[model samples]
Structure formats: structure tokens, C-alpha cells
Target: MREQIETADRRRLLSRLAGDYHVQTARRAATFMSRDIVTDMTILAITRANVRQITASPEPVAYTYEGVAGVPADGLRIPVSVYALAKDLGLPYENIRRRVKKLLDAGVCITVDGGVVIPGATVVRQSNLDLIAETQIATEKFVAEAGRFGVTAAQHYRPPTADLPKQIIRLAMNYFLDATTFTAKGMKVDVVAVLVLRAINMANISHVTHDPALAVTYAGMEEILPHEARQPTSVYSVGRFLHLPYETARRAVIRLEERGLVQRGPKGLFVSPDVVTRPDVLEGMLYLVALTEAYLKDLARVGIAYRPNPGSPG
Candidate 1:
């Protein structure tokens, strides 16, 4: 079993890297990284692709891979001939397999019979072409966003390969869709949403005295906005989104402002500047957004009216 897997992996590398690599070069590329992180990334991709299945596939199980490591919500692998899909995309079939597998291991996609399929989950597939095009589009969207964090795909390579761009975009899509950010404008948040929030927060906290609770809220502001807009970062709008009270909203904003999180400005409130520029800070902010979303969801579940206010945190 191990030999079959290794041989298959090697063959994939040869086919994908054929244009630039000799036989020896192919071997070198295969050894570039261990399979652990690669495997984790694959799992992430499979989980995203099979969003519903990873969650619990509505459809009956076709074939089951027992004791499947990194099995997602569905708990069944949607087997796909990823090599074939790469060919359809006109991508380097060999070059992208490792990446595809990484996604698989990470739970982004599942191996189905004919091809690895992006299951119908949060993302709708109008056509196979739509799926491919959308995936490509998702990749580009993420690259532009990552650039702000100095994590451009180009930075990792000297002259950046074609596969690098595509792979980065794929990874970006994963980072993006993981959020549950819903906007008041009846739209969805994307990379620009994060950037705008980061920038807005940075613009807001320039003058506020720091407080703890407010800091927590503003830190996650990037993930909660209605998209890129020049609006205040007070949770009242978010409270409005969650149908909270003016006091609940007011308290949330004041708390964040006290913590140097909600910076008041000529434009409106938003996150502090330092939160946007620093990656570690930005990550913390992302974590905050996630945490806030979960908390708000709990409030909504039972139709509770827990509106926040502009009260100072005790």
C-alpha cells in the first residue's frame, strides 16, 4: 500500500513538473517538504469543498473510507480523481496533486470515483465550469488580501510559478469562507472586508484610551463589517444586525474605545491602526471576530434580547 502511494505520488510530480524538470529535478521537488502540513492543508480544502458532507452529507454514503483521518462533518470521503480535475483546469496535473492532497487531508475536498468533487455546501455550483472559475476567482481574491499582510504568494518564490499563484488562491478561499460574517447591506464579507475593517480600526483607535472589553470587540472588527465601507465600528450596527439594544450597542462601542480599540474619527469608529499592520495582531483580531460571532449566535438561538450598552467595563 505504501509503495503504491509513493509511486503514485512520484508519477504525479513527474507529469506536473515535466516542462521545467528533468527526472532528477522531479525527485528533488517531491522531497521539498514533509507530508504533515501538506496533509493538513489537504484536509482543510476537502472540508471546505465538501462543506455539507463534512458537516453531514444529506445524500447517502456511496463508498466509505473507514477510519478516514481528517474526516470532515460528513464523515464520508467524496472520492474524486483530482488528477483529472487538474487536467480539466489546464493546470500542471502533477504539480498540483500534492496541493490537492494537502487540501484533502485538511478536509477541503474528498476523493470521489470520477473526480474529486467540491460538494454542494455553502458554495453553490451552477455548473462544473462555475466551480472551476469560482475556485480560481477565490484564489485571486485571497492573494490581493494577503498582499496587505506581506504574505503575497510571490514572496515565497523568486519568479513565482504558475502553480504557486493558483495554489495560493485556493488556500486563500479556505481562509475566507471559514468566516460567518454577514453584512447589514445583505452581502457577504471577503478579503476586502478584512482589509477595510483592519484599516478602519487602525483609523479609529488613534486617540481613545485603552479598555479591555472594547479592545476585544474592535480586534475582531475586520470580520464583522457589512463589507468595505466607511462606517463606525460600534457594535450597535452589529447589535442592529443581531437585533440588540442601543445600550448593548453603545456599551460595546464605548468598551472597545476605552481599550483603544474603537478609534473615533472624522469619518467614524473602527479598529486601531496597530491591529491592521501587524500579522500577529491581525490574527488575534480574526480570533476575536470568530469568538464574537459565536457569542452572538448563542444570543439569537433562543430569541433573547441581550442588547449591549455604552457602559464602561467593570
Candidate 2:
């Protein structure tokens, strides 16, 4: 019998899984902020504001909308306009206009001089904080499980001692936002539809911890030529996962089918094989791989080898 993972190995695996969780939840958060559901463009707008915060001087700058006074120390405050955000994300003017209106009306965004901004009030709401706190709790549980497995950091590994979870979250948010922008422009598909595709495609690996067999089967399909991972998922499941309306998720999937990005499989819906090899899709894959690799590398600092089990999916 193969030896079980040691303490160090489990720790490393936990780190890698933590990286994966950050990416997944960041994508979910990007799509579903607060009670107000938003389109891809709106997601981009939020990301743009966050990016400003990430790159701002004086680390951990608090972000507040324009005209908001007395910003907190932790706020990475920045103002972003719909037009500029639209141009940056390659979204159409009209579409962004409509979405921005919806976002503002929903109090998820604030408007400023000929532009809009994500406000401190909105960001600091107890609900949002609770969500992040919940994510942290989940991450701790994951690490504890890893410890149980005797996983330890690699001998040469150096763990990031400062705000590691927050760092990972920031990285993940930027990655998914950039990827969505790329897909929207390259595939000529609405960002919302692309988001749906992403969620569907990810259903397989996302469930590995709960259902290892299912994950392996899905992984096997993905490994076969001309076959993508098969996820027989419904709009309700996708919508619930992304916090989108059922109809909205359904329509997005329909749009994806219309655009040939996905197909109706007997299993339900799967990404189209034809599009799997397309340059746009490949480019997106490369981007995702790069991001994950970087995260793994960071995990390696603390003695964790990046050895993933072939029998399981993540």
C-alpha cells in the first residue's frame, strides 16, 4: 500500500488548496458582491477600483468613492468611472452604462465626477466583512485538516508571514478579472456568459474534497483529446453558486451555446471541444496556469513540494 501523506506533505497540500480556494472564492465574490448581482462589466469595475488600491502608495490604503471624506487607514481608496472602466475592460459603452446604473441603484457602487467609485460604506458593510471572515475560517479548517495528515512545509520552504490569505485574495481577484476581460474581447461573448462558462468548467475540480471519484472522472475526460471536462450542471446550481438569478444564469448559458463556446451535452452542458483548442481559450488557460504556479511557488517557500496527486482533482 502507498504510504499516506506525511505531516509536511499535508501542509504543502493545504497551502496549495488554500491557493485554489482563494481563487475560487475570489471569482465567486467578483460575480456576487453583497445582495446585488452584477454583470461582468460591473465586476470589472469593482476589480479596477481594487486594482487601484493594490497599486496605491502607502500600503493598505483605504479605498473610498470620490467625495467620500475621512477614509480609513486600511482603505485602498480609489475612484473609477464607468466609461474608463468600460474602455479598460473592453466592454461596450452602452452595456457598461446599463450595468453601472444597476450597480448604483443597488447601492453596490457610487458615482463621482463623470465617473463612479466603490464606496467605503459599501465595502465595510458587516455582510461583506462577515463573508471574508467566513472564508478565513474555512481556510483555517482546511489547514487543520492538512495538519492532521502530517503535512509539513518543505525543508527549504519559507512561508509568507504577513497577511497571507489577504495577499492570495488580492492576487486571485486580479487574475479572474483580467481573464474575464480577455475572454469577453477575444471570444466576442458577453462577460456574464463567460463567467457562466468558467463556473461550469470548474465544477469538476471544485468538488474534489467532497467527491474525489467524481473529480477524477472529470479530470480523465479533460485529459482525453477533443473532450473537455464534463459537468452536467443546471442553471439553478450555477446561479446558486455564483449568486446569480436562475434566469440570468440560464440565459447566459444559452448565449454561450449560441456563440459556440459551449454545447448541450447529454450530461447537461460542457465547454465546446472545438473552442478548447482555440487560441483565446488556450491563452486563458496559460494565464490560469501561470497564476496557480506562482501561488504554488509561494507555498514552496515553507518546504511544501508541489506534488499533486494524479488520482484526485483540485
Candidate 3:
């Protein structure tokens, strides 16, 4: 029989897996949205609202990805207002307005009566398709990784009838936002700071999941990874990876270090094991695990049954 992981061990494994997945997805979104992760997030929120509006039906609507992507600009019934955007994103009204204006100027988003909406044409573009495909792959990889640790859906496998890529994307975006918001609030830091910190963590352990030996060793003991196994990464590399400015990355790192969340050495920077095991940080990790579980459950409701690998060590 496979060893059943305790709740605490499950939390640690899921938190790390979720963090890595979201950071990579955000980085890809940033690249697709002209090197601005926030912009991509903003657009995602708007698109989600619009999709909800369009798909509001008393009966089940099996909307395919192509069908939804083909909806005309005028067909977008509900436009997400700037105020709503700001509130949802936990950003200032003026800041959101400015970003909306920039998007309008770039023709990436258009002004409707209530607010702004990304054009259907934009959604159907090659870049957006590539993003969707990449996100799907990432989602699958996350499921597979979780399976290796004996985390699987409670339901039987059932394939989705509709190609609801938009719904999947919306859920993924919500997960990202929830994770970021939870960490930022818990740590008393901003979204950028949360991203910076997560990026650093990802850099340090990016190789663990790929190596079977390392993955098995690190599964429930991530907080106690040996110093030699943890890779030290620089602010410059983190900045480049996240498409953040050098100063922004540097300042975030400094802030983290001041809070005893990170440490700098002769080679580079790394988050120490002690810091990872802090009560507050562990709380955040548990929260992430909860969010991830909810996400998987939602996927099942959407008709995508995720099963753990049967051959995986129990």
C-alpha cells in the first residue's frame, strides 16, 4: 500500500507545487500581455466577468472554446467597470483607470458603456491560443505532480463535454489571484513583493520536482532542504524571469531580507529553512493547499476528472 501522507505533509507538497505552477503561468501571461503580469491579470478578470455574463443560462450550456471565442465585441453583455476591477484586484481606482486607458490606447481592450472588454478578435489571436495551450499543459503537469504524492480527486474520471478553455483559464486566474492575495495579506506585503518572493523560492527548488530521487526526499521535508541542494539565485535573474525591473526586484529582496524571510550569501540569495517553517509562512502554505484543493474540485465539477497516477508509489 502507498503511504498516506499526513495533512501537514500534504500541505507542504501541494503548496510548493501550486506556487511553482502559478509563477510559471503568470510569467507566460506576462510575456503574452507585453511583459506585464498585472495587465494580464486585469484582462483575465474582465474576460471572466464577461464570460459569466454571456453564459448566464437557466440550463446547462455546452459552450465550446471556439464558440465562446467567436462571440462578437457587441455581444459582451456585461462590461467590467474600472471601480469593480480596482476592488476585485485590490488596486487603487486611479491606478486601474490608468491601466485601462493604456489598454484602450493599445487596442488591447475597448471601452464599452459600463467599462472595458477585451475584443473577441483579440481573444482568438494566435498569442492567446498559445497561452491557452500552455496553461492546459501546466495544469496537467500540476495534476500529475500532485498524483505522485498521492493527491488525487475523490471522484471518478469523467471527460468534459465542452471545450471550456475560458472556464479553465478563469479558474486558473482566480487561483493565482487568491494565492497572491493570501500571501500578500498574510505577510503584509504587496503583490509584486509576493511574486518576487515566490520567484526566489521557485528558483531555489526548480530542480527538485524533476529529479525522482530529490523529489522523494523533498516531498514532506521541503522546509529542511539541505543547503547544498538549495540553489542560490540573484535578484537580476529573478527580475529577468518575472519581467520585473532590476530595482523593483532588488528592493523586494531587500524588504524580504529585512523581514528575515530571505538571506544573501557570497553566491546569491536563498530563503532559509527556518524562515520557510515559520508559523505565519506555514499558515500561508496551508491556505495555498486549501485553495489548490478547491481548484481541483472545481475542475471536477466542470467535468474534468483528475486521477492520481496508479503506478505512482503509494
Candidate 4:
């Protein structure tokens, strides 16, 4: 029998996977929350903590549509303190406190005896038919992509209920926290700063890969560009997308430049090939593969109907 990976390694792998997953998930959630990035992120931080608490249970978490007492039945009511959110997300206490208040005032979250949680009503509002449809499409695509790396045995599994989108977001959020923790130690920078860098890289990729056919030329591998090739991204754009302050984003970009992770391009700032190919970066990619395999197993455990996606490359 194959030996199981140690718990620490598994956590690291999942965190890395979740971090990459956040690049898309956060954007989606931000859109749903009316483009309030701080509020959205604060809510996610609490939800992620809640999911982690439940997932550590001795048995597989069962689905529930009815509330027990006053707590949300579907989403595990894991109470999270504001200070904990600040510590976990590497943001300042005052910022998290303010966002938490906004969420509370907006009915997006409720305070329980111990702490705050996203209520069932809020979740219901968030998980509309459009969001569900979008999630189904994205989940199918994700399963198909994971198959290329030999992690597809449970690809066809679908969650038994309509709450899969929420679950996916929860899992992604949990991974995001795990990722932020690991990265802060490894790169000695805030997670928000890392996000700025990722935003710039994604912008550059979008600029170059004009169409699927052009992307096909690289066969899904990282496309290398000559140093002379200009892939410029403005700090304002990155800040706007991430909901960060312009000065904060600019400082982060400056720090990355000093570390040789990004360089000024014809347009603005772009990720350096050196940074992309770094040993630590490559290892993170490996962790993503491991996380995908483990995530599939978790889905199967929860009884999602596993099947090949129609978009699978076959």
C-alpha cells in the first residue's frame, strides 16, 4: 500500500492549491458581494475557519438544510473572532474590525454567543441560480483540468444538493488561509502583497494569450517570454482589482522588484521569469497537484457524483 503523506505536508499542499484557487474564487465572491473586497474577504476568512473546524470532525460532515436552534443548518456555524481574522489573514486589526462591523450591519453575518457567522439567509442570497450555474461550469472545468495530472478517478462526482457552490467556496477559503500562513513564512511578506504579484502575472498572461489557439501553442506549460518582450501592468489596475489601496499595492510591487521577483515592463510591472522558475515556486506547483488529488478524495467522501467533464481533453 502507498504510504499516506504526513499531515503537515498534506496541509501545505492543500494551502498551495487553495491559494491558486483563490485567484479565481475571490474574484467571483467579490462580484457577488457587490465588489466590496474587504467585506467579502472578511466574511470568507470567517467561513474558512468554520469549514476547517468542521472538517476536523471525527466523521464526514453530513448535509443539512434545516437550522438547529438559531444556527445555520447547511453551513457549519463556526464562530470566529475579529482578532483571529486579523491574525489569520495578516491584515491589521482595525481593518478587520471595521469590515466585520460592515458585514454585521449589512446582515451578511450575525453575531452568535461566542462570535460571528454567516447566516443561512445570507448564504441563500449569495448562492443564487446564476452563481450555481457558474459554479457548476467552473467545477466541471476544474475537474477536467485536474485529470491531466492523473487525479480524475472521482471527477464525475457531483454533490447531492445545490449547496456545492457554497462548499466549493468554503474549501477554497480554508485553503486560502492555509496558503497565506505558509507563504508569509516562506516569502517573508504579507499575503495581500503576494496577491498583488499574482494579479500582475495574470494580467500579463491575459495580454499575451489573446486566444485559446495561442495558448495551445504552449501546450498548457508556462510560456516563457524574452526579456525584451513588454508585459506591462499598471499598479492602479492591480489595486482596483484586488480592492487594495493604491499606495499599498505600489509598495508591494516595489518590494517585489527589490526582491527580483518582478520587473518594470513596457506597460508597467510584470513577473520575472526568474521568479516563476524559482525552486520554491516549482514546489508550490507540485503542492497544487497533491492538493487536487486530496480534494477529489474529499469530494468523493462527501458523495459528489464523480464523472468526466464534457470539456475534458480526453
Give the top-scoring candidate (TM-score). 3
Task: Give candidate 4's whole-model lDDT.
Answer: 0.58
Model 1 CA deviation exceeding 4 Å by range: 1-46, 49-124, 127-135, 141-170, 177-199, 202-260, 273-314
> Can you write out model 3's per-residue Cα lDDT over 1-314, one digit (the tens) per residue?
11244543655666677889878877988887768766777787777677765554322344434466424354644788999987777777897788888888988888878778887777888888878777777787777677666666636334554455655666677788878877888987767778888999888888885565666667774546777778999999999999988998899898998888889989999987888889889888878877887787666555444454533432
Give the per-residue lDDT of model 2 (tens digit) for 1-314.
01233211222233234334544564546444543334544654564574564543323323334433223323444567667777766767787788878878988777665467666666556665555555545544544443333432233244343344443444444555665666677778866676687777556334543343442232321332235434467778777777777888899998888877777767677665566667777665555444444433434442233223423322
On a 0 to 100 scale, what is the lDDT of residue 149 in model 4?
Answer: 27
The window of 10 residues in a row where model 1 has the poorest summed lDDT is 14-23
Off by over 4 Å in 4: 1-21, 55-71, 74-76, 126-133, 148-163, 206-230, 243-248, 300-314
RMSD for each model, in Å, please? 22.5, 8.0, 3.9, 6.1
Task: By TM-score, rank the candidates, best first.
Answer: 3, 4, 2, 1
Runs in model 3 deviating more than 4 A are 1-8, 53-76, 154-156, 221-223, 303-314
Task: Report lDDT per candidate.
Answer: 0.34, 0.53, 0.74, 0.58
Q: What is the lDDT of residue 291 in candidate 1?
A: 33
Cα deviation of 14, candidate 2, in Å:
14
Q: What is the lDDT of residue 201 in candidate 3?
A: 88
